[model samples]
Target: METSFKIAFISGKLGDVDGVSLEVDKWIEVLTGAGHEVFTIAGLYTNPLQSISSDKQFSLEYLRFDSTLQHHYEKMMFPYLTKHPTHLTSGTRDIIVEEMMVHGKELSEDIFQIIQDNNIDVIIAQNTNAMPMTLLGGIAVYNLLSEYKVATIFHHHDFWWERSRFSQNRIEGLLNKIMPPSDIGSEHVVISSYSAHILSSIKRVIPTVIPNCENFGKAAVLDNYNSHFRSDLGFDKTDILFVQPTRIVPRKRIEDSVRLVGMYGRKYPEIKEKIKFIISLYQGDELDDSYIEVIKNLAKSEDVDLHLISDRVSSVRILNNNGERLYTSRDVLVNADLAIYMPKWEGFGNAFLEAVSCRVPVVVSTYLVYKTDIKSAGFDNLEVRDNYDDEGLLKIPESILIDMHQILNDSEKRIQMTDKNFEIGKREFGFKMLSEKLNTLLDSYSDEIRASRRRLQKSKKSYAV
Candidate 1:
């Protein structure tokens, strides 16, 4: 690894409850630890960047997508963006193509400024290039990388081809150019094998798999965290803690967690009142606000002890003036009796991986990534399908109790499961493993650039003679 290079991480929104933001932060930790300078440029960021750098690190010159002409382009193309096979009238398709041509030029300029200002030796573009949510953002990145000989690693979390929202767009020209590893001087990296396979089918670019992982500090539980955590949250030590460490987003299908808890209470009447389902984060309907209302109604009707603790927890641990010690997401995971992760769709389930890493049993939905990638790694848990399974809903909490008893009563079983998972996670998602893959990709890019420069120098010398 070249320790002296300045690496820049670019994203549409690099901070918040989203998976991309969380994964980017983990990359920052790994990359910075290896002695490379790191910078962030995003439309949104909640993390403090004082440690990253004061001068070189920059945020979006314009933060909102609605501000740019790109938003209007996507808005007008929505009718043609549907995945269902339908013939768009020629007039509509022509209008959409014309708009794309105009926005493409404006987008190119934004990207050029970001690259020049940061003096970015290499770019780690996070998910923006993969998903066309900001279509012009993808176009901008593609244009800049194609023109400048900058080394880039497109950290693809989800591809436009996977999602239905983008499948029918009339702008195939733009999508083909911007999506994945095509038409850009970049290496492609997907978070799971399934994404890598799908990307390979759509684009000639075969993505390197660099799955997500929890940080070093997140692995071990703090010794006294639970005592203070319970006290602060007004729960007794014996309260059954069911933690859902994800945002309140519709795709997350959080109602499933409520149903799981309610069904568990009905089956195991003994621990009914003792169970507390805590949602440790919030994502307030940034896309569509209706889902938030639906979740609130579901929580209320189910009578589940659901707590949204976003206000209480920060990225760093601190104490309030009243001497109440605040906690991070790690502290919540450390104290959890069981972690419910039932996302209907996920790029990869980082929460499930973190739960197993922290020695907590998990109740996970069999999302594509888990079914194909994580499940094969030997994770045993309550696995549900896309929708609620009546049997799983009724039996999973009891399963948690059985596992809890084994963890507390049988030392050997606990050790076997935890040690097995740790080994599996390290093999698949550990820092040591991922860093080796990352540096290998960067080295190949470095070699190509060096070769091109040498050839250019030789040509100039011959001309002079």
Candidate 2:
């Protein structure tokens, strides 16, 4: 067997229910299984996400790039972003850049110290390079790449230009410069083909497209632990548990799910009575205020049993302070009759893949990534065309309601669809596929790391002299 490599993953915030954190966890698992030592640099890391041995605990503090982490300070500091790109004084803009540069240097120093302490061979930046949620952090990534001799994988989840939440104002210059600036030594990885095309067109840098994947090897079964979810959540055997396994954000088009349930109830009032819509993930909307409230009111108007169960769901399944067993997002998936992922936009379809893995029939809106990267994977689902006007309102499809009702009522159809989708999900997006891609990426690197270390030693000796 080959010797294991040391890989460090750097990110702004982790150990949460966000997609970037989830994907990074998958990468850590795969790399560790392949006998590589995995480590993290982030704003936060939960115990479940960290499996490193006690011996590898050196430089843990250095691993944290604290100031670079995302927080409420961001919207205030860069008010020009997400807003209408209002004009500020030249002094204010300059001060912002100056602060970023100073902080970027400090963060870069910590990264270098971590490399020196841990002898880290490769750096896998998790969603920090492209997105400017924290411009200082993004700039810090550039400084590290330029100043260090380490191998880097800029794993871009999404870019600033792709998101309306980013600024097109004064910081545009800074964003264009270091929000994943072109670096020759470092490798780039995009989650979808759409991003790959755009990166190439805009940045003139082509990258490997490794779609977000799941551990399809693990079968979701009715174990003693997870079997309690349906009853514990107060659902009788008769109630159809329809789950939306995504954050309650505006772009997710969660209103579509509520409206679908409403429309279903109007057609077959009896079936509607048994339908329960549970959003398994947390509510997340920094830009648009009170979308959750709107969703709740809409569900009320439509007379759908919509429950926001994010408080009940967590990244890990553990006992709560009240001695009750806390459930994860997976727990909800296993107990669900159907999953609906109707996002207007997505970096990639993670929740959709999860539904497929859990062997539940799913209904997905044709988000861009799903349309381009995943639709051809041959998974059977209640897929619908992206239905909505400019605003986030749902233009309800009457035809989908009929098919969805038919599918829900039939057990044989559920089995057939779920089995086929699971097989496809396992074949294309499994850990085996991810491992192969990672191995290929690792092979592309030279044995120059050893030589780079020797050069660093010489430079240090001269500096001391």
Best by TM-score: 2
The ten-residue window of minimal lDDT in model 2 covers 57-66
- Where is model 1 poorest over a 10-residue stretch in terms of lDDT? 392-401
Regions of model 2 farther than 4 Å from truth: 1-3, 46-50, 54-73, 80-87, 285-288, 390-392, 447-465
Cα displacement (Å) at residue 30, model 1:
2.2
Residue 261 accuracy (lDDT) in model 2: 78
Query: Candidate 2 — which pairs collide?
Result: none
lDDT of 1 by residue, 107-196 (tens): 556655555555557777887687776666666667556765556778988777666666757676667767764854568888889888
lDDT per residue (tens digit) for residues 86-175 in model 2: 455789767766865786788777776777666677778877778765555676678877876667789999887766656534567777
